[model samples]
Target: MHHDLVDGVPVIWTETPGPLEATLMFGCGLKDETFRTLGVTHLVEHLAMSTLPRLHFDHNASVSLSITDFTCTGRPEQVVDFLARVCAALTALPLERIEQEAGVLAAEGSGVADPVTAELLSIRYGTQGLGLASFNGPGADRIPLDAVRETVARHFHAGNAVLALTGPPPEGLRLPLPPGPRTARAPHPAPRTTRSSWHRADVPGPGLLLSCSLDDQAMLLAAHVLSQRLTDTARHQLGLSYDVDGTAVFVGPGRGERSIQLDVREGQEQRVAELLWHEAVRLATEEPTEAELADEREAAREFLTDPRTADLEVAERAADLLFGETHLDGETKLALQAEVTPAQVREAFAAAMETALLLVPCGVERLTLGRPDGSALPAGGCSERTALPVGSQYRPPLLARARSGAARKVRLVVNADGAWWQDEEGLIHGFPFTEVVGVEVQEGGRMLQGLGNCFVPVASELFAGLGRAIATIDAAVPEALCYPASALRATG
Candidate 1:
């Protein structure tokens, strides 16, 4: 393998005897997008890719929270040529059919369930940079060409990107990209509340999702060992779940999360939940056996050294370069994996439990470790109160859907102060109009969505004067509530 700089961008390549592959990647992604211009990067990528002529090669463009990649696999010259064309397209984006691209993006967004990571990021941070992960990017009707053009000009450049190849470098592999500063990761969102928070995903195969702020390898090994034990207990021994596994993701430097989940039938949620909690507590208290640690280390080594995965490893190295991560070879990584003591792994698990959040099945209740429903928000003590404006309140002959999919009569109380809702469970939810991201109009009514995954739907007729109220509150909301804590702390 060799490293060099081409046209002011870092380029890495390995000489191997096979089909050549190349990837041009950028560090900017959804995290760089503003709340008002969410999905701009994705739209830009789509527009740029749409401009390219078809070539006889495998190619794809992907958008993630922190990176956007354009990769191709084929003959070396062909791949390099394709990438050159891609760079040219990105530089002079054909945003003319942006409306068509937006429609395509909307259809794409609708197919994938909102990632759990986005919600967790929002809860840990806020409706700012990284917290914007919890939101769906720009809607088909909202994103415009200028926004896409600006995002591209700001992010898609030489200094902010990397080029990686699995085979020998090709001749004339020119990346005539504009120079720009490398964008840094979004500042970590400060915690809104003191405790861990839980959210319902309405996903099948419900299980526990945890956001652990632990070091990388430790989190991975701990999750792996715990996953093994839980899988044996839940599936092999008790037959409670058919599958059990754990996944770890790096949310930020030296900070990440591990999610252990189980797929169980309808009747077994509570028992499985109890078993998972028991194992979590046990893992925190006791260390894994030497055999378990050895197995996990071997697994890590295999993943890093496997020849069949050389292309994937090249891609990972390229992405790491963009993100400023230390690049460790297969052997060094294996040694790092081997040096992790059982006690350290146990300590990581124990620490993870301190801020653990559990997602449970809808019917089954009472995970001893989980927070009660709706308790994730601040306890209400409204310092001020205001009644709805005349004719602002209406009792429609029907109900509307909250963000949680629960049915409730749409009752909205809004003033120059803020917005208020009293749910059927007798819990009061409040959002300063400033905190209100946007009001999504639906067939039944208006779903007032807010930060940290909260929503309140008011009947169409009942929210008749809502626009004026929104404007008034929007004007005053800035002064009243600055952060989420302020909004959570004040309401009527």
Candidate 2:
């Protein structure tokens, strides 16, 4: 293995006794984009590879929260040529294909109907940079050509890129990337809701998803330990879940996101969350046993010593460079893993649990769990809004409001303070008029979503006055909330 620098870009190459593989990584992804320019990076990625479909070798591109990876494998010559073409394509972006690429992304987004990860990001980050992850990048299609060009020029530079090779170095590997300073990781946006708020979604399969950000080595190790405990409880003793796993993503120096996920039967969603949290509380306070920590350390050593594939090793090396981490071989990594103390991991767990976000599959019923003390979410209330304009009012019939799987009929009242809906049991749910997130108009009625993760439906019977109601609500909220991408497409 060897590390070198081509121009200003970092290159990590290794020789393996197998097929040749190469990957080119960039330091910009969804995290680099703002709310208004959400999909600019993805658009650039698609456009860059839009010209490479004819290549026979295995080639693909991936865009993530903080990095973009482009990889190809085949004979050394084919791989090198493909990479050169990718670099050239990025240097001189084909602006003519912007609209075409935008259409592709739009179609993909529409087909998926906003994925869970995007929804989580949106709720966690609001409508800002990292928060834009939850959105479908609605403004992607309208981004101007000049803005796209500028994004490409700034991020697709030698200083902000890494190239990794496994097997022999590809011939004529000329990455004539343009000159630009390395881009810094974007700061996270201020969260919009309670740090430990609960988000619910109905997925094809039911699962309990817990996510939190870890900013140090202790936290990372704690995440691993916590995940291990939760997985054992959820999958082994509980007999409720089919699969459980923990994963980590390092976004920047001493900063990353980690998640503990569990797939379970439909009826056991809440129980799964409860059990997971029970184990989390225990780990946070009791500290991991030395044997357990040693087991984790040994597992790390095994994986590092026996990487499944050469391609994986190269990718990890490149990722380390992208996140400003020093490269470590198997022995060095194992040594570092051993240095993490049980108390440090326990303390990390306690801190992480304080800001944890719980996402469960709550069909129609809202699920709330008692978090550990001192880590409870702060109190919140209905947002403030001016009086509803006179004549901008309606009482719509109840229709099914889409949720996990079930919803109930409700009455919507638009008054001075904002809008409040009465559920089947006559429970009033108030959402400040000014805090409306987006309004989705459907065949039977219009679904109104709020800033605090509430959804209500106004029946089609009120369609006669729905237009007036929408206008009135739009008038009260910020201009951005007036017409969401989904609402605009629906109304148009």
Candidate 3:
């Protein structure tokens, strides 16, 4: 399902029966108090979700560089009923309450502590008459109830609002039409104008962020190509980071500027920063390898094969559509990606690299790069060496343990599952069938810790649990639990 606001806010919604999921999205070209209002709106969204009765399991929300979305997943039947209630709550949310608005501000402020994240935010934007960080400093949290009320009063104006319903849009769900041509007083537009021009605001933080703008129609196609190439090069080839990806094109006609920014960590900030700059320069000066270009095309094709009924993907795609992105079905992105030549990528890279490069350092007192002025390369080129082959005679077993420290430890095979393990400390751990992949565990050890896998979604939860578990393990023995090869096998 798709709906368009005359004011240019468009929404797309999809519904599926299994494991019900729903997402509410707000597409706005944000600036000034817009982000503050979004912060409040998000808080209200959470409060609204919490108020729903019989809501089970996952309820999440995210505010990104361009869009803010609220999502909830649960039983199908309950979700249908919940959708109506959510719309009602959104329409009726009280933004005039000072206490409520204050709570929202506090929450947004608390989320900004991470150095890496803060740096990303700082560099992706620029301080103009509009200011640097979109959601930065005390003003970000200083929005008053009246300001929020005023913002909300104009927020859901007919042509400026989007309401999407996924998962069996209620048997008889009827959305209320705005009284008239709903339109808000022109708010701030997003920061992208054309493919050739990019804008970013920076604040003090660790690491470096480089942004380059592209022409309008070209930006999306360029991004699809650039993201795939960079990710494959950085992660699969250079082993720079666990992952490297790009943001979907955010600006459109009369929306704002269109740009892409690359983020590098603090420890290797200088080296990575230089590498990124040099790569951009190199790509601009020359063309990508045919293999690199081909790989990007292949990945993009694979990405568009089929859309899972997942709420997050649906919401993102819907938002992209709202922003005037071309809608393609089934591997169209692949064809588009494939059509882009190494020369085109090189040309786009050269054009974008012209944007001003900014640096923000956090946590560290100062940084001294071996090549501070962007000269010199790491001793070895950024190429990854293949992993050493494991001996055929050795097959390691999966190890699970409940550690006493502030780290929640749960070891599971990637794509295979077997038995659950419980430590003497009463911590329950298990590999729930789908965790294992093609890799097999080999040569298990007792005391020594081996870095297995790092998944952000899981790590975030594990660490929280670890913190709590650590406090309880006063004298408990930290057992090293191991699962023999026989213990892991595909389940029927």
Candidate 4:
């Protein structure tokens, strides 16, 4: 490996047998934006990539949960030209082209991560930071101009970026990004809700999320082994599911979530969910066979021994530098992972299962997924308050309320204090005026998203005569807390 400084940007590279490939990476992604300004990072990436002239070489850029990378593969001159254009674009973005690029982004769609993984993050953290993944936020078109400029100033700079290459820097390569301080996330968003629980969402299958130290190799191996067990039983045996997917996402310097989700056949949701839970429990209790450990270790060996991964290694080192994480070579990681004994795996998984959040698909009849201790896994909720505060009460649309008793019982209250909704089942989703984050200014109404993963839809579509309620909310909340409904987002 070799290192160099190109116009104040740190560059890490290694010679490899291929067309030269280089990635200019910045330590900013979805986790950096507020709920109202979600997609700003992606917008910035699109705007930068849009400025490049047509080229015959293979080149592109992407923004993930933790880093944004602009990459190209061709002659070294192509590499130098691409990096130069990207850095120049970042220092002086073409603001006039935002509208056109936002449309392009909207057409690109919102499938950044697996839907199941995104939902789990939201449940783990609230609707900000990593939680922003699950939400569409204000959509690409609604992202404020000030948010874009602020994001660029705060994150897109020489101090916050690293460049990785498959070979030494090409002559004349220069990264001329503006200078700024390095950025790290505020101490990890405190886990919003208690875990070792379960919930239902509009997902295609069931999945499990466990919070653990990022360095827990035993837990990591257990996750892999458990995934293999599910694939074996769910697909090879019962034929209840097809693919069982797993991923680990970084949330802080030394912590993160490792999750596994499976896609089930219609009518098999309940069975598949039960299998995931039971298999995870089995690993938590019983030690796995020697064969299982050997299988996973051998798989790791096959991947790590390949020569093609030289470019990935360089990029990973760059990300480690960007995030202030300790970077272990592949050999060191493999040795540590291999030393994780079966007993250690059981103990690690058992401890982690206590922090697990099981996700079952929507539309399945309510399931009583029990924990390893035989307790009913509790459901995730926005609030625990039972009673609505004293305030003016608004009922559902008069005609609809008149037709159904349940709709008649629906109550929404907004006053000087705040707003809350009591559903037919009597569960209250409350949002205090002071604790409110952002309010989507919908047509003829406002929707309040608050702390504690709660929201109140004060819209006329659900309740009639909302003019007074809307005025009360607008007068009570800060003007900066509201934005027009996202142009590309269909619902609140």
Global CA lDDT of candidate 3, please? 0.40
Q: Say which prediction, candidate 3 or candidate 4, comes out ahead on lDDT.
A: 4
284-365 in candidate 1: lDDT tens per residue? Answer: 7889888999998988877877787777777778877887877766776677777889898888777676666555556664
Q: Counting only residues 3 or more apart in sequence or on different chains, how many pairs clash (N, Cα, C under 3 Å) in candidate 4?
A: 0
The digit string of per-residue lDDT tens for model 2 on 1-492 reads: 788777677888888766778889998877677544667888899899997659877898878877887898889888878888898899888788887888787766641112444455555555555555556534556555666887898888888899988865665767888888777666555556535656566542222223444435566677677767766777777778876665454435544556566777678777776676677767767888898888888777777777555567777778788777776656765676678899988877777676566666655255445566735543222333223233334543234344312233445576555666655544555576665655544554555666554545555644335665555555665554323343224342
The local lDDT score (0 to 100) that residue 148 gets in candidate 3 is 48
lDDT of 3 by residue, 237-336 (tens): 7666454444333333433333234454446544544454445455556676788666655664556544553454566566555455555544454555
* Pick by TM-score: 1 or 4, better one: 4
- Residue 58 of candidate 3: its Cα lDDT? 74
Q: Give the per-residue Cα lDDT of candidate 1 at 124.
A: 53
Model 3 residue 363 CA deviation (Å) reads 7.6
Candidate 4's TM-score: 0.96
Which is the leading candidate under lDDT?
4
TM-scores of the models, in the given order?
Answer: 0.82, 0.77, 0.57, 0.96
RMSD of 1: 6.7
Residue 164 of model 3, lDDT score: 53
Please, what are the lDDT tens digits per residue for candidate 4 over residues 56-168? Answer: 99999998888899999999888888998999999899999999998888888865579998888888887878777777766688888999999999999998999999998
Give the lowest summed-lDDT range of ten residues in model 2: 379-388
